[model samples]
Target: MNTKFSKLSFTIAVSTAMIASASLASPTVVSFSDATATSTSGSFVADNAIDKNKNTHWEADTDGASITARFGSCQRVDDLVLNWYGTNKYTYSVQLSKNNGATWTTVVSKTSGKGNKNAQNVTDQAANAIKVVGDTDSRLRIDELKVNSLGSTNGCTSSGTSNTSNGENSGTSNPSTGEVSGGNAQYPADVLDLSKWKLTLPISLNSPPNSNKATEIKQPQLKTYTNSEYFRLNAAKNGVLLKAIAGGARTSTNTAYPRSELREMQGDGTESAAWSCTNTDHGMYLEQTLLHTTTKKPEATIGQIHDSKNDLVMVKYVGPSFANGSTDIGKLEARFNNDNITKLLDSTYKIGDPMTIDTAVTSGGNVTVNYKNLRSGVRSSTGTVKMTGIIGSCYFKAGMYIQACSKTDIYNNTNTVCANKNLSANKYETDPYAYAEIEVRKITLR
Candidate 1:
């Protein structure tokens, strides 16, 4: 329901910067046959993805498999164009391998695949190979795989865009590979550099008895939050992982809104930091991969973007949609603007079944959400409203906010212990609380 900088000025500045950074030389488009192919499963396999044949497809046996394209030499690959066959959702990462695949770095993690633009910009990287790996609900039927430079004198090639020639594909594409434009590798933050942010635990509005206004249940400012035994916030190969100790605190309040979030410094809309929280004409963009361990009732949340105070807007992952009002919650749904709740994406999420979320909120009230469920190769998008509160002083937060409340406190405001039994402990108890855990791979801001 709610949501940059001075629109006109910032827009002009950004445009000028873009003009200044333009490359004079044309970029080389790596051919499909340029790299070798390999995968975790399937035969028409890795190579087929780039074989320039709509009739050929690569299928994985399991849900989360991989298809890698290894080049002969290190190439500065900044963007890619992939045409997928069969209309299914996919959650996958476009990764670059510099050290021969023993380890890899992610260029971008995509969660919404259906109707995804063929050209995807990733971190500007020099790697010998690039691969797509993740979870899929249906068999993989990916075609038209081509790699391109972030900025090329020549645009993406028409030959790179795929059609439904193989049969099951359905969608509308102008099919122009002409210099598939891309963004620069401008990731500013990592796990080690989250010092500017402050951790606010279990803040919520009072229910029946505690008064009806939105207020803090227990707004303790823990100084060394990221250093918790039950929680971990660390830099991963390409992104960051915000995790709750496997047996960490899940709930910390009787209020339906139990939270653990990070708030940015006041009026410090700096873009040079690890991640940009600036409200500019260019706006601030954040992309991250989310993974969870629990599917319990009273669905928990994963990622969010908030203002200085008040939960303006956020993403809530309901293990089983609460609207059904039944625990038949095997199917998980990604709900946006949980302050009012709008279904953005839905599927069954497992520990390894990663979902990639791409969000861009403009200085204006415009917000865009793109979701992908890896192997399915299908992506979905939503254009929603981002209120104006945070526009002046906004920050991005990614972590678990369990919404479970103890039965004793469901109707009465008496039960002090949160559902997860994290807080409200005796003065003698020193152990930490069990939390809803999440691993955030990468966060990039522009």
Candidate 2:
């Protein structure tokens, strides 16, 4: 054979062999609902390995780096294959988590892993998330991660949507509706460091006929406060659950919507946080999942930076077919100045998928936002917004700030009175159970 043709034939043969091996390892390949890593090096990101492309690889920046893969719902995972970068030996371990990465149980451990491929039999284990940890001192590199499920379900719920059931449907009784026994009751502060933050509830501190001003809890009080109905820990006591109802109280007489959110505070939370956009750079990050939304208007603002007068940018989720004759399935959007908007993630976004939101504002008043749909490995960014001469002082807010309310929501609570009568009316249920929920696992500010 000609030399060039011979080399091409040999390459094809190797590629074919690798594909066959992958097929055998995963008789029924299970797609990852979401993938995330602690860190990555260069262009080799975590999603690259999960993309099932041998040509692209993920390299850890340091040793002991780990990547997590979550199924949309529960799965009976039995096999996991790691496509290593080269023939170098590696030490690694695989673990399983049933409580959404809160706790883990190790199932596979290898001290001397060789060749370009390594396979481990994890047995038939029930898990919603799987983690592979690099045990070696050197960087862990992988081209792909192949997983096999042994059952008939692919993890999606019956409604053809991703299952993001709350405590009631998650095999655990909801604290809001029932008493939670065992494990000391955890507060939002316990799960997240909230020393520099304060909470704003959807309800008022006083009764009706009095001021309907939304209640604000600061330091000392926030450290120990946990509301079963609005802000508290999840059933597992591993994440903070923020819930808001359309009939909930508003922030002020001028405000239209209700929110169960957190506001950045100054120093020990004794004073309101206020900073000029030209003073210093600011950033905020959150690892959260939207659990539920209102029926007709399934929309909520997850994160945002607001000025003393108006909001600068908002990381929001708009539900499917939200407006009349609209074809939108759902989307993660970055709304700038409540005017210009950019879609970060499209219809693939689901109710119970892991989402990462990172946004920053420069000293020059330029704003930018990036979103990662961990479940679908989709990532997008809003390049930058030039607002040097347009905006002023601003602060950060994160949680479930629902962008929905109806006259029925107001009429539902005959005791309280709302100033905004132009509010949209509920079109779905006679007594709209307009509710929204978010599970915040992690948050950071800088």
Candidate 3:
């Protein structure tokens, strides 16, 4: 018996297995779904490069045609392959953005970029967008841009059923980094990381210049209310408190969604001060604990999308009904301003209980949503359904996205629809006053 030979065989087997696992976990072309590709040059389009056909190319006579594709949301990019109509005068870089676009980090750069098929295993970066930027002096053309990421099993998505038209980008979006290990790992955090989240308040009803459409009829105004004072949290030294104050008075019959909101920004896309809808591929997720709430027993919205027909689907807590039969109250709840509010999961969850929420579109074109109270082990769910609209994207917003409204606002269309508003306060307070208060200890988004 040659002991050395036996050992060598064993080592080969282990290495082979590891390689196979990695190959199995290779990325697919999810960048194709719900992505917005843009180029500086008008004649040469960025979409041509991502069009899935190598023959179709994006070219520009001018140097620095700089083409970029921003995903529907944030995603993890591990490896990328580029087919270029090269130029010795130009160097190309594979840039990554975690914030919406405020900053960029180059993960792959090449000076020897000319007519070539180049593949690079870039440092795995959780970015919301990727770009093929060329040096200023050199003309550029990209025949194809292929990427293999860490989500889904769509055969690396080079060809065949992997095309986005198939409507089954099963391995497409939803950064599955945390889901790849032993089990769906609980995202860990204790509010010690401020870089992990971003808070949004309707501090001003003024539409963000980048926003695609204005969702409100009028942007509110306030004096003496500081945007810096909205969130109070830093390290564990002082626990994170995301407070939402109902600013301004409801003088209109049109409904308004004028509550403070916090959006998670740690993954995929770069953060921006602009309020445009993020272009994403996989999906968006947010999880937090219900530390506290201080309003009349109104309703609060939770995350989940049932199907394509429905936009902005969230589970609502509708305290009690006054019309005798229409309310979502169970009555064994807690007290917020002395009102008995029905609880999600249980009474304990009403105050300081952990809750997990996920919103992502599966490769199979299904809208997937799930919510759970970590303390009570209770989950809110929509089993399954064929989610339509491939040419669409969604963003996540949390913290008092108040569903409350003036009854007149609903019918007149001045404010957000009544059904769209979740819970409410006894009296939606005025400027410099807080009607809803929720202390969020942890928030994780993938």
Candidate 4:
């Protein structure tokens, strides 16, 4: 007789208990250990933003200024609250970094703000550092900054701390990414030394004159630059990703395929890196995985030893060939004589499988290649190419060089659609999404 009343009572009691539990779950307030600003006004300092006093404020010296705060350790931040000092609108972005300030991940971006206070939810985000970069005709001002963190965390540890005041850690430039020093260099620039390489992008400006040329980055700028589409750190922040699409820009008119690759560079990244394969041991060691290849061709060159005109040796992937009943799919082949290849590396390799490859020319000019599959235990080598003559002025190249291209690719259609003689505004995209990607974990050259 009282069933309905009994159910309503139980529901009320459950709701009350849930509300009580929610009220008991409180967030912890995080404090900053140090703060720095790109520019600061006379009386307003970067520390004022985190001082917990709404009366004191931090003001930027100019537009496009940025302020950074370092936590004692990494933290799982739940939310952030910024109290503005004035009614002036500001366009800004919030970025988080786990490795000091070397790399960053944008968490919140505001193109324009009209309110006096802004709160952003960043739950479960891990970061040891935070930065606020703003652009406005009027200087940006922050009265207070607050962060709500999760429970206690040990956070990420740096490999080594910097002793110099310049903020960069002490170490030799990374061979891969060329990062001078950080906690660790485990991802893209994981080998060789980045100071000795340059990056080539499969993109260019569309406007007249130089539109036909691919973009290249070298030296100091290459050390910290990353392009989201062509080259960037993987999600795990432990590998470098190189991508190329079917209709992207080519390095030159004669090149049909586009590539997001690295070329050997010399001192300070200003000169091309070239050396003779005589009296010196030249080699490159790579740890990488092929992530994708165009559906039509399913082929890409991941590593190469190149001369001025031709690739002497290349680690190429051959997708399953339908003509052969698809038996040739996932084969890792070593290419020589520009076209000749040997499937001695791995006949049954699968995409996303990690592999280690070692290609070298001995001091005596004898070439050698070795391969090992980290997961399947498959291994093979080419021993040496039939060295007819010594190769000189050669350099090492790594990253993705997609072997597929569309008929509209720069090389094929330079007349009609591409006739303006002006560079395409961006990378050509004949087959949108038909692309190749490689995760370069490590690359070492000697």
Worst 10 residues of 1 by lDDT: 6-15
Q: How many clashes in each structure?
A: 54, 3, 42, 14
Better of 2 and 3 by lDDT: 2
Whichever of 1 and 2 has more lDDT, that candidate is 2
Model 3 misplaced regions, further than 4 Å: 1-198, 205-229, 234-239, 248-255, 264-285, 291-297, 302-310, 321-349, 388-391, 405-434
Predictions in order: lDDT? 0.40, 0.63, 0.38, 0.63
lDDT of 4 by residue, 275-370 (tens): 875555566667688887776567889998887676778889988743121233478888875666464688888887878677767555566677
Model 1 clashes, total count: 54
Clashes of 3: 42
Point out where model 2 deviates above 4 Å: 1-185, 208-211, 322-329, 388-391, 408-433
Tens digits of per-residue lDDT, candidate 3, 1-446, equal: 11111000000000011245356544344543312222212222344455566565554434333444544445656666554433233465666655433245677776755534556676654665555556545345555655444553111111111111101222222122111111111221212232333445534444332111222211111111223444444233123444443332232324354445544444323342221222322343344544333244345553333221233345444444331212222222211111222223343234445554544443454444445565455544444334434234444455655544342321232234433464354334222243444445333333
Candidate 1, residues 119-164: lDDT per residue as tens digits?
5666555565555665665444455455543332221122111111
lDDT string, candidate 2, 1-446, tens digits: 01111000000000111233355233355666655565444334455666677776656555566776665566655656655545656676777766555446688777887646566666555666667766555566666666654443333222211111111122232211112221343567765667778898877677552234778899989978999889988876657899877766777666667899999888877687888865566767677888887766778899988887777788888886554212334778888766565546455677888787767676568776767777666777677775533456788999999876654454345323332454345533223246788998666565
In order of appearance, the predictions have TM-scores of 0.44, 0.60, 0.37, 0.54
Error of 1 at 28 (Å): 16
The candidate 4 region of ten consecutive residues with least summed lDDT is 6-15
